[model samples]
Target: MKAILAAVLGLALALPAAAGVTIDAFKTDSGLTVWHVEETSIPFVALELRFKGGASLDAEGKRGAVNLMTALIEEGAGSLDARAFAKARDGLAASFSYSVSDDTLSVSARFLSENRAEALALLRESLTAPRFDQDAVDRVRAQVVSGIRSDEKDPNAMARQAFDLRVYGAHPYGSDKSGTLDSVTALTREDILAAFRSTVARDRLYISVVGDISRQELGPVLDTLLADLPETGAPLPPVAAPAFDGQTVVIPFETPQSVAMFGQPGIPFDHPDYFAAYLLNVVLGGGGFESRLMQEVREKRGLTYGVYSYLVGKDGADVWLGSVQSANNRIHEAMEVIKAEWARMQTEGVTEKELKDAKLYLTGAYPLRFDGNGPIADILVGMQIEDMGTDYIATRNDRVNAVTLEQINRVARDYLKPEQLSFTVVGQPKGL
Candidate 1:
């Protein structure tokens, strides 16, 4: 009897577990895609809205317009001034903010379910009817311009900007996500309004709501908030894959630590090999102290305090980046170590122990990403924007676990070529 009972228990444990949270997704009548995760454990709710055109959609000469427009949305919208907007949101104890990334513009709000009406009202105003007051635009532009000047003084920032220019060339991805000082200075209220009008259409929008709310309860709220938005806008043109010619960009800078950035074109988000590439990056450099790059470069040689690598998966393109900082004298050695590691991974590949450890860390840390409503909302929005299925959270572990040694080696051979990488070192080399 004991043996039989133990057998049954073991079999049950071996079965794949279901996701702790389940997402119910559908499209709103307004042509907005909505994803809902209902968790009554908390009394609060979180909402996130994503729009297609981010910095990548900036016009040829109007680089910072999208970003500046996103900021101004929260500054004043509908009939409220910036001060009135703040007071109203604070009175309701709601948290509302907007941000523009390379690929998307997002607005998020977290508030008690009791205050959902007010929160949605404010969010709706910010989304569809932003004032874009001239005063607000001028104020935000000054801040953006100041930030650009500040970046100019930072060696690491200079290194990355140079790397982007070299790796991406004339591609839109090559331009700074934050506009240049000249570009920001050239921007006007007209530019911001035009960008907002062109980008934030209903069909291009995705909304995700998580926390103590059901789709039935939330559907009406969404309808009311998004009612004024237009159903469609101009579809974004497809972005081409960045071609990386083996080039070295050396930008002279006076800093104690030389910043080195290097990378090759990588797989986009929708690629079949994405899971393999993701796991490979973890084993290569994304795993912090346990990563091969950190273990090889910093621990053994004392070359730098940290070294890391990652993949950027955008709507139309992707790129791999590896970065480290070291004394000017050690920059070449550091680059050699990076290149050697790349070659080794491509040829010899990772061992079972390395692969297993990476899987453990990735799976174990996955739940920590949901510690707050804000992060949970962000993840949901990202899934909708990336076209990743609602089951992504549930299947993410399986995806990482499915990456076999054979798959790793095959992907490494296909994607990780050392000679094809472009290197950018920003600082004076000791003997250059």
Candidate 2:
């Protein structure tokens, strides 16, 4: 399904905009913000709720507690057993999903409008009074441990772990969300409860609703669903700026190809030059084959089959990062070419043609993401999380369009740091 969406988005790059999605913003008395759009074509509602201090709030020695608790929140809640909860949800033809990432615990609910009340009741239980049954905790913990065991041998995972450890040091961001095998195995029920209390709270909530629902109907539902949470999250782990000092660390693996993850500090989401940096990223490395890194490493030198880069702008940290996989003997050539392109773009900004092409694709393809209720709801919550304005959906492409070539160049020089790039390579490579 995601591949199909990617294909449609590719087509959207050439096509002009459809009418922009009309998103309405509201707030409940409990201080929870809601972004809504009435897409009644489908008789279903998609709800997304985000709580801050997600996996990052895991207590000492309980690294994966938040993740484990999120997975079990819906497995059993209130008085319902895991089987009972699933049966109840399935009876209503509703779906509930919970996930925890480095920054947030995200809950997604989808249900037919006729079942809204029942579905919401289930969601409320999961949020406000999750049972965290010992049986469910044991099951979920085992699953996360299984995943950790799998990641231990995966080269890409190894490279990513090395990269984060090098960049963020001992910060929470550097910790794996699923945690280490020993950590997951040692997690206690009390730790899970503590993590749940600390992470799912009213002060950090962001909510969005889309599809067959009205503001009047949703207002009370919002308060009922969220009013029971704690007012504030536990103190988040301290913020630490990324410290990349251009060192290459190689993890030896018996493989034909070396996977390299390179990164440096990047501009934050709230920076005035963010949109410019976003546009600049496209020309520098985010444009796939059209990006300079791809042209230099793959099309020009044939050192790698593919290469790409992107910007990661979190609440307190940012990174300009990229990855490439190439034969062990050719990895050095690929790295040199990637570094050269990174340095070159800073010295000589992208061409006008490049700028126009990027703007055309970025602005034209922006609306394709709103083609479904779930995606739109997700995007709405994201807008609030990023502190963008209510009319941001309407004005976003204009912001992308407003970035001039000179501005791109200036931000490029200010932001890009080829010399500070740190590389973490997995596999036996010829050179570093």
Among these predictions, the greatest lDDT belongs to: 2
Q: At residue 79, what lDDT does model 1 achieve?
A: 96
Cα error, candidate 2, residue 163 (Å)? 0.6
Model 2 stretches with alpha carbons more than 4 Å out: 1-20
Give a tens-digit lDDT track for model 1, residues 334-377: 88889899989988888888889888999988977765555677
Whole-model lDDT, candidate 2?
0.85
- RMSD for each model, in Å, please? 7.9, 3.9
Question: Which 10 consecutive positions of candidate 1 have the poorest summed lDDT?
Answer: 8-17
In model 1, which runs have C-alpha deviations exceeding 4 angstroms? 1-19
| Tens digits of per-residue lDDT for model 2, 100-217 | 8899999998877777898899989989888888888888888888899888889989999988988888888887888898888988888888999999988888889977888878
**TM-scores, all models, native as reference:** 0.93, 0.94
